[model samples]
Target: MTVLVFLDPAFADGRIVDAGKPALMATDQGATRGDGIFESMLAVDGKPRKIHRHLDRLASSAQSLELTIPEPEVWQRAIATALAAFADDGGGGAAGGGGGGAAGGAEAVVKLVVTRGVEGSSAPTAWVQVSLPPEAGRLQRENGIDVLLLDRGYDSTVAERAPWLLLGAKTLSYAVNMAALRHAHSNGADDVIFTSSDGRVLEGPTSSVLLAHAEGEGGTRVRRLITPALDSGILPGTSQSALFGAAKAAGWELGYGPLVPEDLFDADAVWLISSIRLLAPVNHIDGREIGTSDVRAALTAELNELIAAT
Candidate 1:
């Protein structure tokens, strides 16, 4: 996996840099103590979809973290500049370029991460950096991904009190999140879906939940597309919103609320949605085999068409 980390001044070809760089803080540093915030967005082709929305969310998250962020326009310009430089390295120009990268046209994923700058012993520093995303390998696509239900449970009320349980914040302290993935992989699953101590579905470690139900006039016909409520404490996935709109446009009924594992087992179809992974239909959960349907394919086609049109 060839990945380039773009620093403030220019692009670099390797990992592990001199800790002397003002933007590069020490591992024992203040913000490195998991005392800050961050955000990641996909810059597909060259244009970032919902760029303003993502930036707005980032600002909200920073405010919740009691941290200040660069101005909206400034951040957007930084994102654009980093993506442009990264694409140039990929041998493509953003100009008649594909809104992003392509066959040697810079068709790569782009990510922007901003930490709480640096801190001496006393105050916040002003360092922030945006970089390109490495290509994620294709996995759990057609055949479906194996997911393990992790035993560790999160408090349902944390989102109300601390709210910054980092539930909504895309902070750098992703140790636990990454651990969940490791736990799932160790248990023979490609990912993990966190549940409450009592087994109510929360969300995938890095994706949103989508439940396919049977609808229509016919008695056992598959029906509407559903996801859990945002009030339920899941991250408000941008892709989820887009897909919901696409579903509505496709004449598919849209629903949202709580969904337990039993509900998943009972559903006609199930999928985990994300920006990069897009649609990953679940064929099996726990020990139950959920039947395959054309719903995901239809939904993906509809979404791709919607995105293309927009």
Candidate 2:
């Protein structure tokens, strides 16, 4: 089941629409040209996780695109309305095994979208969608995944030189991104981590690249977290950012990098993280095993605890 809520000034709490009906126009730029920005968030027990972070990123993207969007409060109200509708019996009989919006099993994927609007129209189209989180993401988080490295066809510094590329924004234009994933699937891999033309590690098609390092066996161990630099033409992951804060508080050293494939190969553990998926360990890269499974599992568990707390 799914729910849709449109942000409208006339409706103080936002307007809940029929998810089954056609809500968007065929000529809408978002539908025709993918001229929009979006953010996917996780809501558990009716509470959205890292909402501020997601909103901030969305605002940043909108600003970069010079597209006017609804205020944060409007989006918040729409999100609440959508979630409530999703929990209602009309949408689905409770989210999961747990009661509607219950803490244990009830979880939803909340998506916020803002389009450039119908061609030549003055108003932009914005809405909130709520649905169940994918079971595949949960499986990947638990059982791990296999990734293939693919070139993103641009230099790492290109975004800095050409702001028109919109590399840092999380927009609705994801054709090539989806194509990359299909390519990985055809090659018997679960996902793709893009590298720059210069061989600098970038990010996954729909996630951020994360590598961990650990030393000193059990008790006195020192663990460090590393991710590619934000300026490396990759979308800044809300989950990865939140996890870094939590990990740092728990004594994990952190580093940002202009990392390369060799760095991923040498890390203690590797993962592809995003808002919806949370965290999924990378067990193999191009058929080459990464780190030790024991170490990877241990670190994954430790970090997942941190993610849950977030």
Candidate 2: segments with Cα more than 4 A from true spot: 90-104
Scored against the true structure, residue 151 in model 2 reaches a CA lDDT of 95
Ten-residue segment with the worst summed lDDT in candidate 1?
96-105
Which pairs of residues clash in candidate 2, taking residues 3 or more apart in a chain or in different chains? none
**lDDT tens per residue, model 2, 1-310:** 7788988889978998898999999989999999999999988767788999999999999999999999999899889888887877443344361332212346788999999999989799999999887778877887899999999999999999998899999999999999999999999999999999999999999999999999997689899999999998999999889999999999999999999999999998999999877789999999999999999998998998888877
RMSD (Cα, Å) of model 2: 2.1
Question: TM-scores of all models?
Answer: 0.78, 0.96
Model 1: C-alpha RMSD to truth? 5.3
Q: lDDT by residue for model 1 over 1-310, one digit each (tens)? A: 1223433333322132322444345752335676665555555566666676667777777776787655676555555655555555562344433333211223344454555555544333322233333334234544567666665466555567667576766666778879989877777677777776656677787788887765565454545878876755567777778777766776678888666778787877777766555556676666566655475555444444554443
For model 2, state the Cα shift of residue 260 in Å: 0.4
Per-prediction count of colliding residue pairs?
Answer: 14, 0
